[model samples]
Target: MKTTAAPGSPAGLLVLWTLTRTALLLCVLKVIVFPGPDVTSDVSVIYRGWYDVLSAGTFPQDDVTWQYPPAAALAILSPGLLPFLGYATAFFVLALVADLVTLALLLYAGRGPGRARRGAWVWVAGVPLLGPTVYARYDVMVTAVAVAALLAGVRHPRVMGALVGFGALLKVWPALLLVGVRRRGAWVSAVVTGAGVAVLFAVLMPGAFAFLTFQKDRGTEVESLGALVFHVARHHGWEGEVLLNYGSVEFLGPYVNWVSTGALFLTGAALVWLVVWRALARRLEPHTVADAAFVGVLLFTTTSRVISPQYMVWLVGLAAVCLCFRDSRMGAPVVLVLGACLVTVLEFPVWFAHVVASDALGVSLLVVRNGLLVAAAVLGGRRLWHATVPGWRGVAGVPGPAPAAETPVAP
Candidate 1:
């Protein structure tokens, strides 16, 4: 869809250049300028290591670090196709492409009017605000799939199904979007499509389900909201060790695994809340699909035991898409989410040493960042619930229609 806003218009051009400049700058810094063991090196190790195995026409059957779904092999193996490019450079380029695609989708979605049009601005500004981490993780590509699937869910059921299925192969989170589908036909299509692709990958790859086995034993990452319990406890004479385990900074000691288990239970409760909310709600507006999806993701991400800095990109992308709808009530919560993203970057690549030390600065950053997330989660849940659930305001004696317009149709 073409935007009514001209390319040279102040809003459009500003957003375009902002994204372009940030991406170009990151490329220079990460690829050519910076020289250190950074996110790129981490990616290089994973993709480049796996690329060799793939080129030999075999799955990484023995590599425990290859802890993603088999479909991720497509991403891991892709750089081998570009024989001329270095693995690190190729990985950055690929991530950059996904970043741009996500920005384009957000821009296109924001072409409507009023606050709905601000969606593009949110996305354009949000990704770069995530700082260098934007191009560092494969999560950005999965976010692109999420953007496309949400955009397609309104008109193309099968397309939405295929996109969600494909995204699920890369990361488990994209499958959460399926709960927001309105029509039963669309729901079934999404499930069947996802299952079919997963089964195909399992048959073709030796370690397709290996990640599942590895994921259950993961420790509580230092950045997760759930990990705050251990972080606070460490100050009060908890005798735990902080170390990089299973590819993330985590707390490993007595009661650490128990906290991780508690986080999982919280996640399960969040899922049940979503299912019940959907069942009780009388309406499913086209825009509310994105809203509900954002809420779902917010619940999962916030409550999980291993929230990485890059995880903010997931919320930022979905929040922008949610804001694309004229009737979307996520305005306030989206602002909180964006603020949290900026703080996440600050806490990570900027003051990560402090985070590692678990000193005053690190704890403060965690407090602010995790506090914002909690606020966003609470506010986002309230907004979506009030919008979808009928007669909510009536309980407060503020009844009679509640001053809202009919839900806007998807573009």
Candidate 2:
């Protein structure tokens, strides 16, 4: 008997993806002016500038804003593949292609036995929720590689490792994707691939590693969890100024360094917790990898000195991967991440001026967005602990298996 497909069936998802993506492309291309600042300027101005420098066979050696790793040059130069189209237009088109590739991967994963289509819906809905910023930044392309890596990890650990190595060079966050992976081959492949790429770039390009030095002086961005201190302090005459530092708007005055240090400390603490979880986890499953990766990224992101709106792309992509598994216990955290994504757009390009000014509306939005992220991180960590660690009740208070009873044997 033929059963009618649900509204979120693969075909329906493809249609919705097409419609929403068209809207995003329109906004990015400037045919439809999105509310707030022109987000596409990054691609047209900053990225194009870097592309010019990279094309000259060198990194942007003198530009402080050239903060990305060497592999980012590929994304900047990718627009050259469609030289007939202008750089900005070609970039947007390529971003859409990356988006499509991610969707295709999710759809294919969802059709496997025991997998669900909820992940596809999450990707389709979550990307548009962040507005045109998804396509305006190169984060979406990096996210596509991440989504592919997670989907492949269950069956192709080597492939997952190689992609993770490449994606990490594109942007550093994808390295977190390996937090939950237990395969030795994946680790070996990641080390080999990463070292190989690092060596190749070092040999071919001068200043390939200059981005490391550029990060040492970064201040807390206006949208970070620590930035709330400054936002509230502004009303209390705390005598600090928000300024564009590095490539982001950051709090640049009194005690800003202290807050940035605190954020780094929190990040260190998050690492300790993950290391503990790895040592204690006994119930490793296929889905546990995605769940742990989601939790790990959430912890680091929530504790980071800069919580840019585009960072939400990484969370959304990881959250979607978690939902692909029927046994995954990240449903609540995924919901919180989606809510955060919605609020991120509001705090960013929509009311970014208010955020920069540290006004009440901006403060409220930051509280909500950062609060959701914090809640998700805590809840996700607890859920992952219960589901994997022995002697704790799993999700929904279901008791985990007790240790096997020792049987007496005749000696």
Using TM-score as the measure, which candidate wins? 2
Work out the TM-score per prediction: 0.90, 0.95
Off by over 4 Å in 1: 1-11, 14-37, 112-115, 393-411
Candidate 2 clashes between residue pairs 3 or more apart in a chain or in different chains: none
| Cα-based lDDT for every prediction | 0.77, 0.88
Task: Give me the runs in candidate 2 sitting further than 4 Å from their true place.
Answer: 1-6, 395-411
For residues 1-411, what per-residue lDDT tens digits would candidate 2 score against the true structure? 753444656777878898899999999988898888889889999999988989988998889888988888899999999999999999999999999998888888887677998998999999999999998899999999999989888888999999889888999888998888878888888778878888889899898988888988888999999999999999998987888889889998999889999999999999999999988877777788899889999999999999988999999999998899887889999999999999999987999999998988999999999999999999999998987776665446634444443212100
Model 1, clash count? 0
lDDT comparing candidate 1 with the true structure: 0.77
Model 1 TM-score on a 0 to 1 scale = 0.90
Q: Which of the numbered candidates is closest to the native, going by highest lDDT?
A: 2
